[model samples]
Target: MATSNLDLADIQATVLRYRPEPYYGTHVLLRIDDARGGREFLRRLVPHVASAADWWLRDDAWIAVTLSYAGLVALGTPEQSLRSFPASFREGMAARAEHLVDVGLNGPQNWEPPFGSSQVHVALSIFSGDQLKWRQAVETAWAQFRDLRGVTLLMSQDFGAQPGDRNSLGYKDTIGQPAIEGSGVEPLPGQGRPIKAGEFVLGYPGETGVVLTMPQPDLLGRNGTYVGLRKYQSRVGAFNRFLRENANTAEERELLAAKLMGRWRSGAPLTLAPERDDPAIGADPRRNNDFDYANDAHGYQVPFGAHMRRMNPRDTRLAQLTDVNLHRIIRRSTTYGAPYDPDALSERDDEIPRGLYFIALSAKLMDTFEFLQREWINKGDFMTLGRERDPTVGLQENDAVFTIPKHPVRRRIHGIETFNVLRGGEYLFMPSLSALRWLANLGG
Candidate 1:
């Protein structure tokens, strides 16, 4: 009988190169199921792990192989030159028992069935830093593990700098991100999203509110959330030209840009220090999270419908939604493109290549993704006065370009236009590594 197991030694070798933390480059996401014989397979796989700190320590880290379901099928084609393992491994898998759920890309929405069902996943990074050294290590690792065939390397173009680097979005990204721990004020103790008991032990003690919990009996350490990735292509030059043509004064243009983003390009929020950019408050953990748009009479510091305000409005008195934290997502956006030049500012040529790979992890895509897109980013009438638009990410209906007349103190901004586009993306599930391997060798 054909078996669904691969040589673990081969898999282990491919995994050893990514050690020493601070992952180098090239992210690999694997979605897996628990092999028929479960705990024994996990026991066999645990010794081969590359990072002890990452594998065991981190709350989100996992030992299972994982991937989006569609992503796994892509590796199944003949062109990949895949080889299968012997029948004996399947015997081992069938003996040990554990949960099996598709970790990524469910069917109907995801396409095709017999997709691996267990929710184990693993995300790893491939490197290019030391050139020959990195290549040598990768080759050595590949020689050992290529036979496993469950793993797929994402091969990121670059790690890309953390949040602030300008993506195609035409503005600095990832500003006002919350601290992992100390924010001075206590975090609201809300059991925002509830997962089953088993999931809590797998990897998500805190992921409850970040990802929606599922109903199936075996949470299998795969509950409490969803992960979304959007690659946005920005028209940078178009934005610059629009600013020049619209605002009467340079100060007026800068203020408008700041209002759209909720913070200045320098990382300052308009709410705290409205008149001027405050790099100090922008960088501070205490003040940034503490801001609510309760007292901005001028609307100069931060407008009511600015992307930040619409996404995380500080106005506690205005009881419009269930809770503010319900919509909060942990953003991990990376900018892709060249630095903007002053000379290029005047060129209205639309060929500039820039944008952001927007990644957000949340408990519910409904609140985090839908709310932001429909209610805030794409909402034409987000504000009661019909004044502000999400300057950076707003989409105009029927491709209509309308203007938001200026505040009383500020001059009118005219000739405004929509400057970005959402190319394409699908919702993805990120599972721990153990889940990834089970899917890779599922059919035998």
Candidate 2:
């Protein structure tokens, strides 16, 4: 996960391999008041932090640590080191509300406690499929901070797969993942040659053949990366009602679902199985992300505004407009709350709370995640669809329209609404393992 040295031992495993599939996890935010205590906390937590060495097959559960800009300042980071961070991250997510479309209902002022606020300084995330392992990881983190009065626990949330292992929206999750050059995993059919390590990890050459400028000191930024975590509470009942009112038949409802998502609930992409879903293909990783938009030039199968296509234009002409590769981001999102009843897909049940914790890891926050949020997700002109936004995550109006390009003529479905609402969001920097030790030894 590092440079040519491949210093996996000095880098957090989450930078490359996030959680394994079908995983359960807990995320906790903290605020620090005492610099010495904060450094000591890092001192004790380093041993529990997992590195990228042979990360793919690791059986043990692990915890990843990230710090907001204020966290670094609270830890007594030197002025030079603090000045090296980009303004976007330094300002924090809440300050950029307008740029991220966090305005309206998703504004920072309406966010949950500890989020969208400078009070948040630390984020500890645990990932594991086994209940015991997950519990142990949480307990490990608890042991470190529970007694440290200087460190206050702002909030904690648990996330995993919904019933039948689908996302909150009743669709398969973790469908698309980036293929990084040094990550040991072989690229899937659709995932081209692994992206340059620098595109993801710091201190390496990206696809552009240039090293991404990092934090001032070599130690702090060598393997560090940026992470943007947004808490979304899905309006499941409203979404189900939206589908029921729009489509006439069950089959038509399913088709409409596939069209909206660019993939069927089974995870089969519309490009390969546009007419009907092939669960076999959906379940198969080799074929799931293999197809491109070249054959579907007019977007007959996958619409231009489809979330997947908009996120990763691939080799299509639209890719040129945005240089999709430059803005490619690694997602490791997790669903929170109890699993919903899939049998009653249309039944309204807004009383209970459940949604996704959208996590994105990238080398540069502004050039990647923020870029997509402002240009691609919120605005429609990037791909020539005026006023169209991402149907799933886009901040929509009462009369938003989702155009589905089809045979004979294009079908325009009006009255689209924002399915995912932002309850909380934070931008943090996940430093390298060596940086962790550096922070621990601070003020020495």
Candidate 3:
């Protein structure tokens, strides 16, 4: 019997497409006032949902729909059916409330209403190359729901970022993602090994060769996956100030930044070009993700605590003990706010409302996404680095320190502050394309 049971046509587009180009996107959060009315709304919206097959064509506008724990219940899903979902999704992001604060999420007191509060029901995402086209697609799809009695569009966030690769912080993002076994995107030279398709999609064997448990009905869980969505607010002015205070020259500053992120601003890996930035190497698809930390175990070239290394410790000693492959996640991030002016770095004091709309997909929410945030990114003891945290995205205070291992002794940088703050987020169930139809036709 085949170990994999995935029908690519049944999966959602976002689960596999690493980079859907010409990207202009929006996320609309909705609240369902009445269970019956909400189910009716889904009935009308099913035709617009894009599938994995749709993404392969890479031409027309695309849309995906996911639901919060409250969403499934609000849509009249039976209690038994609701119980079938994973605990992480069912209890929702609030279950990790205390952990969220430790990971630098804005405290519970400051969390936006309906985000961690279980008030949001539906999450609709629409993306396209043309801004106007994306907007029209959203409007056309939600036309009926606009006046529906029980459905309310609580918030609609517009994300417009050019080039579709770099984040608001001026660094190339999404350079270290694992290539799923069946994603069609080939693994690069230094990307290590191709992760199992089951690690991401349901009904397939993950690293353990045991198929992850699916919810009751096969159709509802077969091609489905869990998603963790968070909106990050970047502190660009503060980051620039830190570099200025730490490094004297522009070249030195770039190198320091590379130490913090494990990749140059141009996407070059520090392990490959430890001395300086190499734009050509970073730009080459084959070379950018072709290096690992085995040779630089002491983190001389790539700091052990660097954001990339901490997130994905590819084929290192840690991998020997723990299966890092099981913890892999597919990231789909987009910058929301305008880029900060590099020239005005000195005059800026106030914070800017710009950062990434972060999204990560995996089969098990707690085992992968939550584990990474709580155990790896927020803590550094696993790498034997002590209390130090990831300078790029870790939770930090004035006393935070980052050490660079030199031959004779180590150099330490102190007074580090967190540059990324979580504004809002939620755990959602990204059901299969067929499951979506089943949800729409629930009662009828």
lDDT winner: 2
Error of 1 at 270 (Å): 0.9
**RMSD (CA, angstroms), candidate 3:** 2.7
> What ordering of candidates by TM-score runs from best to worst?
2, 3, 1
**How high is the lDDT of residue 213 in model 2?**
89
Clashes of each: 46, 0, 1
Ranking by lDDT: 2, 3, 1
Q: CA lDDT, every prediction?
A: 0.42, 0.84, 0.78
1-444, model 1: which lDDT tens digit per residue?
A: 122122222222122111212222333334433233222333344443433222122112222232332443343412222122112111111111111111122112232212122221333334332444445544543443344444333332344432443444435555543322211222322212322222222223333433233312222224323445444556667677776666678777776677667777655677666777776765554564456555764455565556676666644333344545445665655555555542355445444655555666543442356566655565545454353445566654333343333455544444445565554333444333444344334445
Q: Name every residue pair that clashes in candidate 2.
A: none
Model 1 spans with C-alpha error above 4 angstroms: 1-66, 72-156, 162-171, 178-212, 215-224, 248-252, 285-288, 316-322, 346-349, 380-382, 385-389, 398-412, 437-444
The C-alpha RMSD of each candidate to the native structure, in angstroms, is: 11.8, 2.1, 2.7
lDDT, residue 70, candidate 3 = 93
Better of 1 and 2 by TM-score: 2
